[model samples]
Target: MTGAAAAIAALVDRRLTVAVAESLTGGLLVAELIGVPGASAAVLGGVVAYNTELKATVLGVDAYLLAEHGPVHPEVARQMADRVRSVLAVGGVPADIGLSTTGVAGPDPQGGQQPGVVFIGIAFGSTVTALRLDLSGDRQAIRTGVVSESLARLNEMLNEMLTGA
Candidate 1:
């Protein structure tokens, strides 16, 4: 099994469900989680809001924030995480954890942010934390690295939470 699979299994064992809101990495993060066995128990759902409009309309991102910070900002990532958690609640999933990704992964930059710049947001219950990563790679490599690194960070967070570290 992959590291992502192991993480999902651990989350399931803790009876914690997870949800995702993705943009720059697309739905690759969700795809990775769902590829694991017994993911249905731990992964509640996910949203692929590739467009800024959908980030506002579907994920309930604030219009002003999107306009102010653009779609690739840390605030956008945080809102994406919160929105996905709320959406999952409506679906009766009520996930215990929410993960989100927003970034610029391209041959060109957007919103003045360079390619390989990413913000990962993690929400547990009502609290949310955002981490910025300046990565180096091509588009595909950057996306893959973001997905893997995000999961690894989640694992670290879980360990910290479990051990009260």
Candidate 2:
């Protein structure tokens, strides 16, 4: 199975729900997850916070952090993941997992970062982790890579949980 499909299956099997927050990858991360069959059972929703201001106003990213490190920082990714669960809550019940992507993917730099510099943040249970990826590709390729990497990271985490690792 594809990584995205595997992650979706794991989530469903574990009765876990996920919300996504996106920046450099736009909405592609959520799109990839929800594209899998039966994803509705685990994917609550997603936010495309491409704008720095929207990261705070919509996803509740800290304004001071954005002012200091911009939207491409690892902390931004972590905050996006940590907060999206609540932001996309249903009936006051937050999702079990939050996934976020924040980075620069382009021929030009963004927030002083070169293209293909990415962070994928994942929040599950009480732990929040940011995985940094220094990729090498054009804009579209970089974005695609981020989605793939995010799913792989989720799959790894799910396996760890399942095996009690």
Candidate 3:
């Protein structure tokens, strides 16, 4: 199965819900999850916080952190992943998994970081992990890479949960 399909199946099997926060990849990450058949059983929703300010005001990322480290920092990804579960909560219950992407995907540098400097954050329960990726390509390629990596990482995390690894 494709990564998205596998991740969706695992989530449904475990009765887990997921929410997404996107910066560099925009809504592609959530789009990938929801594209799977029966994804509604596990995908709660997603937020596209492409604007740095929206990352703070909408998704509750720390403004001070964004100001200090910019949106490409790992902490920013962590907070986006951690808070999005709550931001997209339903009936006061947060999602079981929160995934986020933040980075520079462009032909130009951003926040003092070169293009393809990306971070993917995965949050489950009380644990949040950020994976740094130094991708190389054009804008679209980097964005697509982020989405692929996000799905792969999500599947890995779900597998780990199943095996208690």
Candidate 2 global CA lDDT score: 0.94
Sorted by TM-score, highest first, which candidate order results?
Answer: 3, 2, 1
Local distance difference test values of all predictions, in order: 0.88, 0.94, 0.96
> Which should have the higher TM-score, number 1 or number 2?
2
lDDT order, best first, reads 3, 2, 1
Question: Taking the tens digit of each residue's C-alpha lDDT, what string does model 1 give over 1-165?
Answer: 576887897798788888899998888999999998789988988999999899999989999999988998888888888778878774565778889999989879998999999999999977888899998989999999899889998898888878999
Once superposed on the true structure, which residue ranges of model 3 sit more than 4 Å away at CA? Answer: none
Model 1, C-alpha of 120: deviation from truth (Å):
0.4
Model 3, range 1-165, lDDT digits (tens) per residue? 988999999999999999999999989999999999999999999999999999999999999999999999999999999999999999999999999999999899999999999999999999998999999999999999999999999998889889999
Best by lDDT: 3
Give per-residue CA lDDT, model 2, range 33-129, as digits (tens). Answer: 9999999999999999999999999999999999999988889999999999999999999999999999999899998999999999999878999
Error of 1 at 118 (Å): 0.4
lDDT of 3: 0.96
In angstroms, the error of model 2 at 103 is 0.4
Better of 1 and 3 by lDDT: 3
